[model samples]
Target: MKRTAEKVLSVISLVFTVLSVIGSFIFVAIMKTFTEGTLRTEIEMELYADPELTVEDVDMILSVLEYFEGFSWFIVVVLVISLIATIIGMIFMWNEKNPKLAGIMFIVAGLFAFILSPTSIMLYIAAILCFTRKPPLAAEDQSFIDNQYDDSMRPL
Candidate 1:
C-alpha cells in the first residue's frame, strides 16, 4: 500500500539521483576534452604560422580556458548539489518522516535538475506524490483502534 509505494519511490529516486550525477560528470568530461582539443589545435596553428606567439595571445588563450573551466565547474557543482538534495529527500521519505519538508526539497531538486540534469521529470513526480499522500499510521495505533471497535461491537 502506501509503505510499498514509498519504498518503490525512494529506490527509484536513489537510482535516478546516482544516474544524474554520473551523467553530469560525463557531460563535463566530454565538453572539457572537446574544447581543450580544439584550443590546442588553434594554439598549434598560431604557433606554427607566427613562429613567435605574443604574450598577449597566450594570456588570451589562458583566459578563455579559465572562463570555460569555471563555467563547467559551476554546472557540475549545481547538478551535484541538486542530486544530493534529492537523495536526502528520498531518505526522509523512506523514513516516513517530515514529508512536507521532503516534498519541498524534492521540488527544489527537480527544478535544479530541470536546469542541468536528466532526472527532473522523475523528481517532480516524486515531489507530487510526497505532497499528496499522508504517512501510514503505526501498526500499534491501528491495532488499538481495531480493539476498541471490537469491544464496542461485542454484546453486553
Candidate 2:
C-alpha cells in the first residue's frame, strides 16, 4: 500500500515543528539579551523619570521577561518531542510498514504539540489518512472461485 499522503503530511509537519523550535530559541535569546543588556538599563533610566511608575512595576516587568524566557525553553522541549514522534512515524510510513503505529504516533505528537497550529494540523490530517487508507484485497483465481464441486467434509 502506498503512503504518499501520509509521508508528505509528516514531512511538512516536521518542517513546521523544526521552525517552531528555532523560533522559540530565537525568542529566548532575545529575551535573555534584553534582560541582561544595556537596553534594560535604558528602560530603567526612562522609567525612573515617570512619577507614577514604582520600582515594583519595573521589577515585575523584568521578572515577567525572565519567567517567559525560561518558559520558551519548555516550548522548545515540547517541539523536540513532537519532532521525534514525527520522525519515527515518517520512518514507518515511508517503508509502508505498521501504518497504524505511525498513525498513532502522528496523532499523539499532534495533540502533544497542539499549541503549534501548523505542525498539529498537518500531523492530524496525515494521521487521518494513515488510519483510513486500506490495502486492496488480493484477487482470487477464477477457476477456484467458480468451481461447482462440493468441498465440504463428509462423515461417511
Candidate 3:
C-alpha cells in the first residue's frame, strides 16, 4: 500500500513540477517583453494626467520598475533551482531511499515554488506523505509474514 502511495505521489509531484517550471519560464519571458516595451509607455501615459506628479516622479517610478524586473529575474532563477530540487526529491521517492531527506527536499522545493502557488502546496502534501509513509516490506519478508499469519489462523 505504501509503495503504491509513494509511487502515485511521486508521479504527481513530477507533473506539477514540470508545469511550474514551464509556467514560470513563460511568465518571466512575457513579463520581460512587456516591461521593456509597452509597460513603460502605458505607465507614463496613465500617470500623465496627474497634476501632482512631476517628470522626476515618473523617472523614479520607471527606475523602480526596472528594479522590479531584475527582482523578477532573480525569482525565475530561484524557481529553476526549486524545480531541480523537486526532481531530486521525486527521484528519491521513486527509489524508496532516505524518505526523510526526500521529504525535506520537497519542503524546500515547496518553499521556493512561489510562481505556481498550488504546485508548492501540492509539493508540501507530497513531502508530508513521504515523511509519514511506512517503508515497504521486502518480498521474502512479506511472504514469510503471510505464511506466519496463515499458520496462526489455521484450526488446531
Q: Which of the numbered candidates is closest to the native, going by highest lDDT?
A: 2
lDDT of 2 by residue, 95-144 (tens): 88788889999988897776458779889889889889998789866775
In the range 36-155, model 1's lDDT, one tens digit per residue, is: 777667865665567477767766766776677667777678777777888788777777777777788888887776644446666667777888887566666454454544465686
Question: How many Å off is the CA of 118 in candidate 1?
Answer: 5.2
lDDT (0 to 1) per candidate: 0.70, 0.84, 0.75
Cα misplacement distance, residue 31 of candidate 3 (Å): 4.0
* Candidate 1 ranges beyond 4 A from true positions: 1-10, 30-67, 115-118, 135-156
Q: Of models 2 and 3, which has the larger TM-score?
A: 2
| lDDT computed for candidate 1 | 0.70
Judged by TM-score, which candidate is best?
Answer: 2
Better of 1 and 2 by TM-score: 2
TM-scores of the models, in the order given? 0.60, 0.84, 0.67
Of candidate 2, the 10-residue stretch with the lowest lDDT total is 146-155
Q: How do the residues 1-156 of candidate 3 rate in per-residue lDDT, one tens digit apiece?
A: 455665566567667767766776776776677577777688788877688999889778778767767877787788787878888887777777778888888889888877357777777888888888876666664444445444656866
How does candidate 3 score on lDDT? Answer: 0.75
How many steric clashes does model 2 contain? 0
lDDT (C-alpha) at residue 96 in model 3: 72
TM-score of 1: 0.60
